[model samples]
Target: MKENVALIGWIATVMTGVVAPALILALIWKTPDTLLRTGEAGQFVSATASVGGFFSSDITTVQSTTGSIAVYNTFSAPRNQLLVVRETLKNGLQLCAENKPDTCVGLAGSWAGDMKPVPHARHRFAGLVTGIGNSGASLWLLIGILVSVGATGILAQHVDREGRRRS
Candidate 1:
């Protein structure tokens, strides 16, 4: 009976895990391209941009190293945004310089928003974009909640004891 109960709980968790995100995406996104939209409209779209210098004071935003230029919001958390942008730049280097030499430098490009940041951090960051729209800025918040809930439930099932152990 206890095993049955555990099984049911696991199934419930799994169902909720899947259904909740689906429902949220359906209601929030409301379109097929929603996930791919950029800058407040949808998930961060991938683009190529020039490499600006890094900052020790505020790593969340990458400023243009040279002349007054656009700053990328990064849309990353305070903790890992630097690294995420670094990797993205690494990939972009390969894609733009190696893959397509013609578009290596100059000109405006799009950037994919990364949401992997420290959950406890209490900062909301923005980046430079081609243009701004009125899309909700809380999409990252929603994705974070879904991931946290799903992970917590899974951890509970694994760590939970079915009954008291016999001596």
Candidate 2:
């Protein structure tokens, strides 16, 4: 019985350390290309102009970096109206805007909003915007794997002690 318990524990430990991490990396690798997208929309404004009014529609993109969401306005041209951008993350929110008059160039809006910083919400796998959620899931999976490996190591030691005591 002790031998069986020890073997089971050892298998679990090895699975966590070896199989788990590999599975995570594999999932990340298998993640589709659309998971990462780049285009003019996501680029920084070359210059600033005046926006007529508050923009109702906003452009957003997911970056390669985990937990980072890029948001921007289609009105790239700067206008007199100040374009307030906000980004909400898991921790908190961030604010940024394109001040008028001067060209609002080089403003890569990711995870930022106009009013309040867009709160970072867990990504949903189902829907049109799966990339962001998929990335988030992948990140969480990796973290879980790491935690599992650590726990496995600690449990392995306990199992070994029990095995020794029984013998």
Candidate 3:
């Protein structure tokens, strides 16, 4: 029974020390590689400054205002560009707006975005923007590291406590 408890503790320690961090990294990695690659290559634009043609009809805005935008190669329409933008509005409203004629409406907030070249697709590019106020890859990496370290510390403390109790 004693041996079993120790083994369980060790297993927990190992999992917390290794598995937790590995899982976080895997989750981040599992996201479509193309999306990450595209953001790295795409241009960063500011929506407030550059975006024009301001039109909104009860625009469903949200406090967090997080969203994603991506451009994908259209296999059916090889000659045309497909731009996709997904946003979380402030409220439940269908407000439509676009940039002014010939004007480039920048992305809103501190959005992390990227652009990548599509393979086998002529003159086509793909990109994504995480959305407003997202901390981006660097921040997520930092968070993962911090959480792993914290978990390890907590496990170490638990082991120490158990050791003291046994002795």
TM per candidate comes to 0.25, 0.32, 0.28
Better of 2 and 3 by TM-score: 2
The sequence of per-residue lDDT tens digits that candidate 1 reaches over residues 19-101 is 54455444434322111111111222233234446652211222321122223332221221111121121112111222233
The regions of model 1 sitting more than 4 angstroms off are 31-49, 52-167
The global Cα lDDT (0 to 1) of model 2 is 0.42
Candidate 3 per-residue C-alpha lDDT over 55-124 given as tens digits, one digit per residue, 9 for 90 to 100: 6212112111233332211111111122222232111111112221122222333335333433433211
Per residue, candidate 2 scores C-alpha lDDT tens digits across 121-157 of 4432222243333445556567666767776676678
Residue 5 Cα positional deviation in candidate 1, in Å, after optimal superposition: 1.3
**Which 10-residue window in model 3 sums to the lowest lDDT?**
88-97
Candidate 2's clash total is 21
Best by lDDT: 2
**Reference-based lDDT, each prediction:** 0.33, 0.42, 0.35
Q: Which prediction has the highest TM-score against the true structure?
A: 2
